[model samples]
Every structure is written in structure tokens, then in C-alpha cells.
Target: MRFARVRLAGALAALAVLSAGMTQATAAPAGKPPPPGSEMRNVALDTKPVQSSTYEGGTADRAVDGNVDGNWAGNSVSHTAQEEQPYWQTDLGKSQTLTKVAAWNRTDCCAERLTDFWVLVSDSPITARTLAEAKAQKGVTATKVAGTAGRTAEVPLHRKARYVRVQLEGTGYLALAEVQAFNDEVIASPSPAARKWVKDNPFGMFLHYNMSTYQDEQWADPNASPALFDPTDVDADQWAAAIKDAGMTFGVLTAKHHDGFALWDTAHSDHDIAASPYKDGKGDVIREYVDAMHAKHLKVGLYFSIWDRHNGDSVELIQNQLRELLTKYGQIDYLWFDGWGWQVPYSQVPYQPVRDMIRKVSPRTVVANNDHLGTLRTSDVIVYEVPVQGMPPETNARPTDASDTLDTNRTWFNTTATGAPRSASDITDNLARARAGNSLFLLNVGPDRTGRIPQDSVDRLKEIGSAS
Candidate 1:
């Protein structure tokens, strides 16, 4: 196979492929082809058994257990105490050329514990007992790979070796969901099908209708009486009709916001719609919303806030809520995660487990985190909330969406005082700008406390749709 050596300034030089066939192989009937230019094959699957420096509650074999849901954790304490570094290793049975190494971090909890690591490949047996000894070994090439919070670290190793080792750098703990080694093939970014769908449906509606809507607050107090969350005239069909009339292809409803008040009946939380007086404690807004969207043949999306003021920032609780949403709904198209900076930082949140659960339940659901950037490496789409300008510069490598409110003011939820709706020209201009930058434009409209969108916003959206 032909190869090219790529040397980054002041860093270790490694070989990379200049042509497409360097990692290309025949595809199985059921297997999809790798993205355009790269060929990737997972070589760590069902290979020789794996070994680790230390483990707790499980063997090192769990790291290569071929189960994305399972994980291997270090024996060190979960706190911030400094301790010896942890490591996991496996012999490939025979020396083989390697291209990339992907290590999945623990997603259920303690995701930030695994950070600043090294992927080492050696021809001889890896005899180093400690992390320092493993790094000091001669004739061994190593590539430093930094962990991305709760995402996989797919490090490229353009070298050859029979033994592969992953050693942690700092204190905390060493945990990994799975470790994979690829020979010559690299997975493509943002599948072509996904990209095309986003391009085709560039305009969607963001329905900010939740318990907070009744309180006229962006973030309602968690202790607010559940009886106050009463919508007199609930009409999911009207919301769907408004969006369809606006020429939007999809709609995202606030299923659960920062208040920890669920719009659907959740068995895990008593503070959900089922506990509220709406529909005599028997309402399921999510069900009506899903049915309405499906009847209109429009895609359905749900907004779930990661920060929970009432739930006390428990990782397992967040995961359980996500499981309920993903499984209860038949087929959700998008999942919008919001409220980042509250009690727990995004790094500490177990995003990978939630992401994995979403994939397991609804494989086609597009995941978007409100990182407030043009794009994020971990999320499928980057979201910009209330952009003053029409759209941000096209800097993100993935699809982007600019979400803003119809009202001129910053109010996300309903208010008694009505703000002037953006003129049809203004809405059209924003859409044009978003399309120019290859981004989706999500226009927000908050329904009143009585669960009905204002007439002015509906008329404005219809005007905007006709102008387009």
C-alpha cells in the first residue's frame, strides 16, 4: 500500500495515506461503504484478550468486550486524589499496520475522569508495569490523544506494532467504554444522507411551549405548584398546522426544560404533566405532539435540557429521563439539549451514555447540543441561540442552525405584554442569510398560557412562508 508521511511542526511525525485505496477493502453485503476518501476496518473486534494495569469491579476484557454500553474503570478512587496512572493493553497476536485507535469514554458517569492519554504501539511485548515505564520504552511510537469530555478519542497511529497500549496521564480514574484499532480505513464525517436532509429542510419551527410558558418565565422555579401547569385549550394539531402553513419541514417542542417539569407522563419523575392538574393529571402532551406531526407528515423533534435544577444534577437521573423520552416516543427526528451552565458543567455530564441511548432507541434522531458555536465536534449540529445578526459565519464542519424568537424582545416564553413581531421582510432576510451560509433557520414562537400561539406570530409566519 502506498503511504505519505505527515509531520506536524514540533510534533512526532507519522505516516498518512495520500490516496483513497490505502485503506480500502471489499465491503460486505450488509455493510455500508466508508466515506468518500478513507477506508477503515475495525481490527480490535474479537482479537486476542486484553490486559490492564488495574481494574475495579470488572476485568480488562471489558474494554474490548465489543459492547458499546459496557465499560472498564480503574481501581483508583473516584475523587481528586493523585494516584498512579492506569493503563490497558492487548496483543494483536501478530504485527499489523495500524492507522487509527478509537477509545470510547465511560458515559454512564465519571466521564471527565479519563483525560490526557497516550496510545502506544510496540513490536516487542509491552513489559512496562507502570505508566511511566510504558512511556519510556525504546523503539515504541506513541501518539497523544486528549479525551473530549464524553466522546470517543479516535487517535490516528500510522505505524506498525503487535502490542497496543492506552495509558492515562493524570489522576482521577481510567475508564473506557470500548477500544478499537482500525487498519488503513478512516470513518467519514457527517454522512452524505444526513447532510442532504439538512440542506433540503433548511427551515423549522421551535415551539417553546412548556410549564415555563404558563409562568411567563424563561426558567420557572422547580418548586412551583404542579397544579399551575394547566393548559385550558390544548391543541397539538393547531401547532402542527401553524408550522406547516409557515412552510417549515420540522418542529421541536420543549418536552423537558431546566425546571425538570416533564411535558409527558414520565414514570421516573412525579413532577411531570401526569402530576399536573392539566387533563385531570392524565395528559400526555408528547403523545399529541407526535401524532400531530406525523399526521402532517412533518419531522418531530424534542428539546431536553441537560441542566436540571430540581433533579440535583444526577447523571443516572438524566440518563433515565433520556431513556424514557427516546423509548416512549415512536420515532423522534431531533433531540435538542439546552441549559448548559447551571449546576453541573458539560464536562461532568454523561453525554455519551445519553447519546448512545438515543442511537439505540431512535437511530435516525439527530442530536444537537447548545454549545453556542457554529458547530461542535461531538454534536451532529451546532446551534446558535438568538443571533443578533442573521447567521454566523460558516465555520462549522457540520450542519448548523440559527434559532431565534419571532418577538423582537429576548423573551423565550409567553408574556402578557406582546412584543412587535419581526416583519415578514425581516424573517425572509434571516432565512436567506441562513440558507446562504448552508445553515438551518429555526424560528421560535411561544404559545400563550392557554396553549395557543398568538395570531400575530401565526400571520407573520404565513407571510414569511409566502414571501419565500
Candidate 2:
């Protein structure tokens, strides 16, 4: 949200470097003119870059290094040797609400290689390893530039994206001088579907209920006995009421965690509440939590861990559990996935297959995967662990939320009575900070051993609510 130039301070060095690439032609490249707008900043300058392939000494970084040297001999042009749909991509650091993309073609020779190139904007990181995989990822928008966009070409782009790719179809060779991306000083927003969760539900509660809660630790052993999970006095209504009274809009219950313990009576695995003594092994914690949240007219969220230590890289088992939750639970609004990309890479359990299943079962559900992916690369929103990551950014480029514990010691699960909860002033201050950054604040309130919110935490929540 701040307006400034991003064209790094090497303007003089860039000009000196570009001179070696130019030919006898004194005239500049020809292209369409830019439409009216605020001052433009080249976001592509010196940013992280990659391409389909590197030819000779031409790396992807040359194109975006603020050098428009058109000749290959100048070492400023990026030439991709691979033939199949060659492309160049850049990460703009964060999501950018963009306006236009200006691409400079090779001037000395091989200008034909830049013909019929496309400008693509994507929400996540792209895969150009295979032509089939590359073609399948049709981005948010793809603008085709005719061959006439010769020399200096300005392609109109009115959209938002984090990753921008410059691609050519049926590539014999893809060569480029420079690529500059401009923005009109507006931060890229999340999709309209996400407005409800990130914009409307700005204040939410994180219910850290799981085997970890019973075992009195952040993460309990995978082999922890299911019989130890007994919560004889568990009350979902109390949890829901306390959240509602605190003026929160949503709650994320831990349906299953890294230990492979399912809170519901999941048929996929017997390591669930059904195997426990709660309600004589007939308890469905998710069922009660969902019903209670819905009764109070609040959005529902479920936290499911992808890195199941007990299950051991079982993708099919993950899919079946997700299917059960989506189909059985009515209108679940959010899913917080943990230990996917950070703990376990996506190569083991591909992100697309799991994403496809979610799209089919519940298209509207917002997924906030807590895998420490800084941006909204593989998730619908960014999850900032307030304790671990400190605080959310001063300005968020995409939908974001900060999750922290109310316990003064910052324990996520109930290890002891929350006798010293965060003060109302401290909690409300963070809430205001997140709101100012246009993000949600998911403050955690862990329930104690008897399955009841600590009275001190409840009273503090009310105090914050009153202050608000």
C-alpha cells in the first residue's frame, strides 16, 4: 500500500551494461503506449527469477536485472534452449495488484524468438517441468502478445498475481531482453470467495483441542494410548458460547493432528475418539463442535495435519478422511492444514490431488495450510504463527491471519490452568494491528483438562470484547 519506485539503485550500471547489447539502430523499440495511471514501479527489477531452461550464458536473472541489452553477446538477454513452451517466471516477493508488463525483445538478431509470447499471472508457484503440466496450469489470466509487439512492447495487464510468467508457445527458443512489471500502488487482495473469511471474520478463536491437549504438550507421541484421551466433562456448547461472547466470528477445532488421532469416529483409522473412553467410545468431537458453532451462527473451521506420524505418508488415507469431513459436516468454512510443505514436501503427497478433492467436495472452503509457506503459494491464506514468526507484516499483500496463544507462556495446548492469560490491552492491541494490516487475528484459547475454557481466559476474553 505504499507508492514508491522499485527500480533498484543500479540505474547507471544497468545503462552501462546495456550498451554492449545494442546494435547500430539509434531508435528505441516499438510498442503500444501505456494507459493513464499513477507513477509506475518496475517490480521485476532484481527479483527472484527462473526460466524453462538456460542457453549458453543466458540465465533468467539477466532479463530482470534492469538491463535491456538486446544482443546475446552482451550477456543481458535470457535465452531458453528447450523447445517446448519455453517461459520465464518471477516471484514479486508478495502478491501484487498489477497493471502492465513491458517486455523488450532481442534487437541485434533472433527477434523472432520473442514472437507470440504470452504474459501469465498465477496465484501459486508454476511447474514447467513437462509440457502437459505447464499447459494444465492455466493461470488467473493469460494475455497473448502478437508478433507486432516488437522491440519494446507494453502488454496491458489488469489483474493481481504473486507469480508472473512470460511464456511462448511451441518454443523453438525463447529469448528476452528485459521484463518490467508495474503496479498502481494497490496491494493485491485475495479472491472474492475469501473476503468472507479474511475480511468479515477478522477475529476468530483457535481451539487447540487434540491428543496434545490431553497429554499436556504441544505435540504428543504418535503411539500415545487412545484411552488416555478421555474427556468425561467435555462440553462443545461452552466452547462455542465463550467464543461467541468474546465477539469472535469463527473457530478452528483440531479434528486431527500430527499424532494421527482423529477427533471423529473416522473409519480410515482406529486412532480416534471412538477408540477412547469418552461417551463410551461413541463420541464425535467434530460433530459436536460443528453443531455448537453453527447453533451460534459462527463460521466453522477444522484443523487437519498432513504429516501424520502414525499413518506414515498415506495420501489415500488423507483423502478419505477429508472426504468424510467435507461430505458429513454441513458447510465447513475453513481447513487449517499443518506439516505439509515444511515438514513433508509436496513431492510425497502432491498438492494438486488433495486440492482437487477439496474443490470437488467443498469448493468454497478456505484452506490456510500452516506449512510456513510465507506467501499464499499453496494456501488460500497465509498463516502467521505470532509466537514463532513474531507478528504479521506491516502491510499484507494477500489474505493473512495471525494465530497466537492466550496463555502468558504461549503454550498452544492446555498444559496447565491458564492462570496468567494475555492482558485485554495486549490482546486488543494485536487485534487492532492485524485489522490495520487488513488481516484476521486468530487468538488461541486452550481448554483445560476437564474440557472447559479456563475461567480466567474466559473473563479476559470478555474484557477484550467489552474494550472492542
Candidate 3:
């Protein structure tokens, strides 16, 4: 029963000869078969991968070093740090109904973890396009497949595509072991019924918090000391209950703000609740928030800032912590991110990591970056945080649900402070306007120096709650 190596090749050759007439892509030659008592299941050695380059050095400055195998030598794409596009375009030789994308990790001996990645498909090669251009163009769609637990990414195919590209972007080094593309029928776009469901639910909360909250400021203030975090009445449960009472369906709290202060307990950095001054600082705000929201049957969201004010060397630290948050938390429904950051330039760096985290942690939850491109890329919904309401419908302002709707599905919602409420009528008018446009109204309440929701705000919420 022991088959020599040569016999395995021979067996593959025989299979290829038998299948040649029916299949377009040729199979590997039959060779030495499996050894005695060994089992090989579903082993189809048809297409072997060819390595183009290996980036082992810090940046892409060093020479590309790696072996080239199979047929992808000239067809391979080399990525230097200079090569802004981290994607490799490959053709299946003929038109293929690609159903899946298998990305191989080919890195030098020193390559670290992969920071992030995304898959883009088009009948033609994907050229660089701005957020604007990507929005305007059609036939180009991408799905984020990084930061997930698995390596294989299944892409349903509806239309035939000759060329497929895998774009890798993030903090880590780069290399591609191999890419296997499967063919199948392309998938149709989302239905109108799905769009309608999301549009009806308007008015959600957007919480922007960070270590600055430790300083009682929005963003990190360099002049402020980290020890300034002292809040006696920091009860997330109360916040959630207040939101629920006001008829809000979901609440998005800032897990980490621009100052990189994580609202929850984190293993990566020391800047978080662990270091705060609430109840000797043993509280995890995120945990309480999640528990409270679930208690109220309200959707829970975590807002993270891609921008960090503290040390920026820990990109890997950042991603690992995020993975923990998504996997550990029971059910996070949304991921909100900012575009501007200290480490990566917005234009140069892609938000694939954030998108990937959302997909991996909570596939059902929508992921939105600060840039409107979130609407174009991985986000199922669009959010315009503009305060002005009842503006005439424009293309940029058009709803994802309908062309005529000023605020339709994937629509805009207001997330700004409503100043001091001179009277209950002001709050009522703002709420009515938001409801009229079919948009969510997220009113901001600036907490007092003690980190307690202002009594006036609480009174106002009570008034609003009674009205709702």
C-alpha cells in the first residue's frame, strides 16, 4: 500500500488526463501516490501558487527575496512600501465564476502578523479611486475578510470575472503565500425590503469619550494630567436606562477615544478604567454599558477612534485589543471609527482592519468610518452627523433607500449638542424635525466637571421621556 512520491504525481497526471476534456483549468500531473495506510481526502492538486516577492525588512526598501514556483512568476505583483496599492491582480487564465478567494501568506522569515486585508472584484482591474470616485463608479464591490478567525474568505460569484485582486493594508509587514480563486455565479445586490427595515428606526446615541474624559475634555489635552480622571457618578446603567426611556433603539458608547483611553478594561494598554478614579477604579464602563443595554433590550454599539494620541508604535497592540473586545463582548451591533489618526495617513491607510473586526466580531452589525466612504465600502448603513435638518435633497445628502427621500436608508442623523434648552418646546421641536425627515436625532449632553449627566440634561430627558 506504500506509494512512492513519483506515484502520487502519476496519479494526479492520470486524473488530469481523465478530466482534461471536461475542465478548463488543467490539473497537476499524477505522481507518487500516498504511502501505505495513509488517507488523502478531496485532494485536488490542480493549480499551484507562484510567489512574486517577500517583504521581510521593516519597510519595502530592501530587495524582494523569495522563491518563485509554478506559473505566477511574471504574473506576480511585488509590493514595496512605495507601492501604495497592496493588491495583486490575477487572471484565472480564462473567464471564471469566482466563488471564493484563498489568500496565502508568503512572508520572509521575520514577517510579523498581518494587520489587515480586503478583497475587491471587478470584470476589469481595480484602479485607484477616491471615496468620491468609488461612490460614483459601479460594478466594483468589495468585502472585508481580515481580522476574522479564519483565513479562507468565501466570495459568492454572480457575474464572471477574469481578474481578481486582494488588497492588504495595515501596520504589519506584507507577503502573499498564494491566492486561490473559485468560480461561481455572482450574487445579486441587497433587496429593497432590507433597506426599508433599517430606515424606519431613527434616533440613536453617539457617545464620544476618551482618556480626555479622564480630563473632562472631548479629545486628549496635552496640558491635562492622566490622573485627572475622577468621576463619582459614572453609572453606564443609568445612561442606558435614560436612553431606553427616551425611546432610542440603540446606544453607541466610545470604547476608545482619540486620546486612546479605553472605556472598558483592556489588556493592551494601561490607559483605561483600570487607571481611573471611579470606585477605586475597579469598574469597566464598557462591560456595564453592554449589560445595561441588554437589560433594556437595546442594541449596544462601541465607538473606537482610529486616531490615538498616546504612543503610536503599538499598532499590533491596538488590533489585538480590538479582537478581544469584539470576541469577548456578547453582541456588539455597530462599530464607529474616525478617519484621522496619528500613525497612518487617511488617504494612504485603509480602514480594512476596522471593517474586518466588525465582520469577524459581529457580522450583523454595521461598520462605519468617519469618512463618508464607509457608506461606499463595508458599511450597510450611512450616517451623516450634520446638525442641520430639513435641507433640500441633494445627491450627497440623498438616502441610500430612495433617490427622493431627503433622509432615507443609509441616511443622515444629527449628533450635536442642542445647547441649553430654554424650554421644553425646543427639545420637542428638534425631536419633531428629526422624526419628520425620517432621521435619527442624537442630542449631545455635556456632563458636568464631576462626570455626572447634567441635572438640567437629566430633567430635560425626563421631560422628553414623558413626552415620548
RMSD of each: 14.2, 16.8, 18.5
Please report the candidate that would top TM-score against the real structure.
2
lDDT of each: 0.68, 0.75, 0.46
Stretches off by above 4 angstroms in model 3 are 1-197, 213-216, 222-224, 313-315, 340-348, 372-374, 387-419, 422-438
lDDT of 1 by residue, 1-468 (tens): 001111111110111211222223444223444453233556775466445444445456656544443222222111222356667777877777676777766644666766888888888877886767887898687777765434456666666778888777765466666677876544335555456656877999988888787777777888888888998988889889999999999999999888889998887788889889989998999999999999999998899887777766777888788788888878888888875422345456644555666678778888877643222333567565643222534432456777887887756777764487888898888788777656788888888888888888888888988998
lDDT of 2 by residue, 223-276 (tens): 989998988678899999988888899999988888889999998888988999
Rank by TM-score, highest first: 2, 1, 3
State model 2's lDDT: 0.75
The collision pairs in model 1 are 39-185, 39-186, 40-185
Model 3 C-alpha lDDT per residue in residues 81-130, reported as the tens digit of each score: 43433444454555654445555332222223333566666666455533
Evaluated against the true structure, the overall lDDT of model 1 is 0.68
Which residue window of length 10 is worst by lDDT in model 3? 1-10
Ranking by lDDT: 2, 1, 3
